[model samples]
Target: MAEPTLEQLREQIDGLDEQLQGLLNKRAELAQKVADVKIATDGDAVFYRPEREAQVLRQVKARNTGPLDAETIARLFREIMSACLALEQRLKVAFLGPEGTFTQQAALKHFGHAVETISLAAIDDVFREVASGAAHYGVVPVENSTEGVINHTLDSFMESPLKICGEVDLRIHHHLMLSEHTQLDKITRIYSHQQTLAQCRKWLDTNMPRVERIAVSSNAQAARRLKDEWNAAAIAGDIAADLYDLKILHRNIEDTPDNTTRFIIIGHEEVPPSGEDKSSLLVRMKNRPGALYHVLKPFKDAGVDLTRVESRPSRSGNWSYVFFIDFEGHRDDENVQAVLAALEREALDVRLLGSYPRAVL
Candidate 1:
């Protein structure tokens, strides 16, 4: 066969791209038909059904006989779903910040880059926005690998009517960021959120014990404030550094190298079990000894694995405490339902905070 000219090869590739675009448009038309069917049948208009998408992603990952990786395939499908979802509903998401926060990055990662993300002031505001239907979903940090738990997020669950639909675990890498004009040695203060300050405590004690610490509302906010000052450096994530156009003076500055924060996706709809599931519950027990023990006994007897248990101050009555429990199983499971039923009778107030699939990440 004759060797093809570079111009001819380029033309052929362009022609293939045109065909691909045409097929994509046709596929979208079919998806619209599917949407019309769903609407006419009084069904949901969300074209990117999470359960189905998850299954597709799992299957694609499993059947990987590929030059392309599973993550790459999933990314492409996510973009396709983003286009489909836009046709179905304008995907609205709320995250904590003044932008460039880890939560904002997580919201994008979970919902994909196409979602319309809004930054709220507090984590509670994110929950409220989703609870009141102002946003389709809210993303907030639930726990950190090094910091144990985010009590505000857990405490907010007690009051909010929102349910956990999904989760995304982002590996957090804290960095010391400052403007280019900032002096290297004259660093008088280091700014970060209280949680960030706490997470990097050991590092601070060992490295810069004399640097005055100023706690801000969030890492992004700290980075935002750092833009104006020359002697101050912000301890924030790489995303914040990029957003504020700051230079990273130090990278992965947290005490732990394996730092990660798990974010929960809060919404109204219940998620079906993905076989691997986690359930959260809040139980208000009588202000007496063995009250909590009584509540947890059933799970212990049933051989159900308890992942987390925390006691938050009860707002209901005097001297009472609410126990937040996380266990391994779905609400739909018989054994899990039986345990919950048993707990309901023993506890004063019981709230099921939705069973969701354990995150693949």
Candidate 2:
């Protein structure tokens, strides 16, 4: 048998494209039907189901066999689901920003670009917006692989009644950018968020040691400042660089190549189990010698895997401590419930922040 000619292959590709388009439209029509059914059943319905979306993405990734990688395939389907959900109701997402920040990128990644994103000045404002019903959900950075934790984010959760509905892990790439008016030889000062500066500390020390480094409210804010300054450069990411029309002086200048930041989705609703899930809890243990041991004992006994455990100073007392814990299994799971019940009897207070699907993409 002869191998197919180039013309024959092209014809086949075109036919497949047409079929894919037809199927996509049919999927969209079915999504509309689902929305109608939801509205008919409940006047107030949440179109975006985090657990359901997570499960879909997971299945997409699992079943993928390919010319395309799992992540690429999942991302394509994510946009499709996002568009479908928009037909039902567009979600309002709040993120810490002046716009063009990594938090905004994470929100778009988790919720898809179809959402109406509002950029707030601070993390607390993101929480307040979600709590006040101004936004349906909020995205805020919880921790960075390079940097230990985002203290402000943890503190905000202390007082808010919001729950973690979903999460996204974004690989951070800091770029040293400048405006068209700036001269590389005359650069005297640099601007970036404190975390960005810290992430690129080694690079900055070796290359621009003499340059003055100033920490700003956010990397996006730093990029904005460069628009009018001729002697200043900003350390930011691609989004900010593009937003401010800045030229990249250097790319991926972060000291750590695999630097990643984890952002959490905050909302009022409690997400149901998605098979593979994680739960977060804020626990205040009585100040005692074996406080830490007692707090961890329940999980150990219940055979739950603890992913993370971080301590923060409690506002309730000068010497009191509050622990933020992340563990495998949903709160609704039998093992998790037993663990929580055990903790309640011993701990001063235990607040289940949420049990959400783990990052699938």
In terms of lDDT, the best-performing candidate is 2
The window of 10 residues in a row where model 1 has the poorest summed lDDT is 44-53
Instruction: Indicate the residue-level lDDT of 85 in model 1.
Output: 65
Candidate 1 residues lying further than 4 Å off, grouped into runs, are 1-27, 43-48, 65-69
Clashing pairs in 1: none
lDDT of each: 0.84, 0.93
**lDDT by residue for model 2 over 267-315, one digit each (tens)?**
9999999999999999999998988999999999999999999999999
Best by TM-score: 2
Instruction: Estimate TM-scores for all models.
Output: 0.88, 0.96
- Global Cα RMSD, each model: 3.0, 1.5
